[model samples]
Target: MSDEVKVSDAEALRFHAEGRPGKLAIAPTKPLDTARDLSLAYSPGVAAPCLEIFRDPNLVFDYTSRGNLVAIVSNGTAVLGLGNLGALGAKPVMEGK
Candidate 1:
């Protein structure tokens, strides 16, 4: 890659500061355009599955995104051979992953 194509420190900082600070966002998997959809996605219609999951804990994977989602957690004490860098310093690295 050429030097001009590489991201500079100022560009990296500006990219994060432009709109939302973080790189992650949540989006609904089901339609939520109507009141019925809202009810199904949120309240009364959601209760059936909630009750099922309550009855069987394993149903949580079927009813929720838990099966597909992954969470990466770290204290930032050790990162990619950089040594103990701490949490704030690790934010960019974690987001990249």
Candidate 2:
């Protein structure tokens, strides 16, 4: 196998710095065009699902993004090439990934 990197370190840095800093962002799946939409997305309408999830924890997957999203958590203790760099050092590396 080849251990070649397609992008240079400087190029990668520029790509991230030129944009909105990080690669991830949050966006609403539904439209919030009116007070009713706001209430449903935030207050009274939200309570129904909250109550359901409270009764059955597994329901969180069905009602929320938890089912579709996977959180990548690490302390950088085993970073590639650089081992045991700790959480603070691992943050930038993890975010870049």
RMSD of 2: 2.5
lDDT (0-100) at residue 82 of candidate 2?
A: 92
Where model 1 places Cα greater than 4 Å from the true spot, the runs are 1-23
Candidate 1: clashing pairs of residues = none
TM-score of every model versus the real structure: 0.66, 0.72
What is candidate 1's lDDT per residue for 1-97, written digit by digit as tens? 5666778989989987788887877888899999999999889998999999999999999999988878789889999899889998898789878
Tens-digit lDDT track of model 2 for 1-97:
8998699889988987786876777888788999999999889899999999999999999889896676789978998889999997677677767
TM-score computed on alpha carbons, candidate 2:
0.72
Task: Give the clashing residue pairs of candidate 2, or none.
Answer: none
- Report residue 88 deviation for candidate 2 (angstroms): 3.9
